[model samples]
Target: MKERVRAVLVTADDTMLVIRRTKPCIPEYWVLPGGGVEPGDESREAALHREIHEEIAGKAHIIRLLHTMESEDERQLFYLARIATWSFEDRTGPEFSAEGRGEYMLEEIPLTVEALDGINLKPDEIAHVLRGTMEAGALGDGAAA
Candidate 1:
């Protein structure tokens, strides 16, 4: 099975950092920052750190695992994290330059159900979970702990 990691990045302003993806033939959607775990990665957390750096040129302090999704062929782990800074223009992820991969824009959105309703965020399951948690004041501390 393949493994992937994603970050639920929260900023000091009480917003979530996400990637807005726009492809030619598909509807635009938002997603968290992350990618597959490479063989060279020392651990899942290490892989998340590397992905965050590559995708947004950001440094993050991962708080804890928030949610996990599993299927026959893959397991996706979502982590709650806080980011101090990032430069979207300096992103070095190869996917950004790949042909037909579409536009990846960094966006900071309020962590609210209304915000979630306005955009189509991938991995619907995770989005739903996050929204519910936010409404319940569970994300006040930035993680699921």
Candidate 2:
């Protein structure tokens, strides 16, 4: 069973840091700033810290386990976080660069329900869930709470 973790860093203005997957070469998709959970990882949170750093050069505070999804033999954990600063010039590491899953395009966009309304979001599933999840008040902040 393979497991992965991603940190969905939302900004004060409600935008998300996303990465366009440029490898595996199958109908390219987008994902949050994160990577796999390695044995060297001290913990899940530690992995999140490392992944975000490598993927988006992002530093954030993990708020909670926002969502969990499983497919066949793979499991993905998405965390809700707040990012203070980030830079694409610093994004680097194995499995996500010249040493791994090709190159990735780091993009940030408004994290809104409209993202699901044919907004050309990547990783179709992500855009699908974001709208309902945020609107359901599951994020615990209630959009304005």
Candidate 3:
């Protein structure tokens, strides 16, 4: 099975950082900053840290594991985290240089439900989870899950 890690990266201004993907013949969508867990990674959290750095050129303090999605051949872990800084222009993820992988634009959107609804956030499940959590006042509390 394959494992992936992603972060619900929240900023000091109560906005979430996501990547906007644009490709030919496909509708635009947003995604959390993350990637597949590598075999060399010491742990899932370590992979998350590395991915956050590679994808956004940022360091994140992970608060806690927020959600998990599993299928027959893949599993994804989502963590809630706080990021104080990032340099999108400095991102070094290999995917950016790969041909035909599409364009990736780093974007910060409000953490509000309205913002989440306005874009097609992939994996549908994560967006739904966030919406429910936000509605119940269980998220965006700052530095803690």
Candidate 4:
């Protein structure tokens, strides 16, 4: 089965960093920063680090594993993390150069139910889990740190 790692990146100001995707003939949607766990990766955490660097040109301090989702063909691990900096212009992910690929723009949004409601975040299951965690006081105001 394939494995993927995603980062729920939270800034010091309590905003979450997400990638806004815009494709031709489709409504725009947002997703967390991450990608498949490649063979070169030493571990899941290592894969997360690599993906973050490639997609956003940033380094993060991973706090902990926040959630997991599994299916017959794939498993996804989501980690809660804190990032202090990033340069979207410096991104080097291969997807950025793929032909016919959509735009992947970096956006910072408040980690709130209202924000979640206003955006179409992929893997809605994870979004629901994140919202629940936030409402339960497990992931805001440095609570996860």
What TM-score would each prediction reach against the true structure?
Answer: 0.96, 0.80, 0.97, 0.96
lDDT of predicted model 3: 0.93
Off-target runs (Cα >4 Å) in candidate 3 are 142-145
Give residue 46's lDDT in candidate 1 (0 to 100).
Answer: 99
How many clashes show up per model? 0, 0, 0, 0
* Candidate 3 structure quality by residue, lDDT tens digits, 38-145: 999999999999999998889999999999999999999999999999999998999999999999999999989999999999999999999999888777884453
* TM-score winner, 1 or 2: 1
Best by TM-score: 3
Alpha carbon deviation, residue 64, candidate 2 (Å) = 0.3
Estimate every model's Cα lDDT from 0 to 1.
0.91, 0.73, 0.93, 0.92
Which residue pairs in candidate 2 collide?
Answer: none
Backbone clash total, candidate 4 = 0
On the 0 to 100 scale, the lDDT of residue 32 in model 1 is: 97
Across residues 44-74, which tens digit of lDDT does each residue of candidate 2 receive?
8999999888867778888888778889998
Please give the TM-score that candidate 3 achieves against the real structure. Answer: 0.97
Clashing pairs in 4: none
Which candidate gets the maximum lDDT versus the true structure? Answer: 3
Comparing candidate 2 with candidate 3, which one achieves the higher TM-score?
A: 3
Output the lDDT of residue 103, model 2. 62
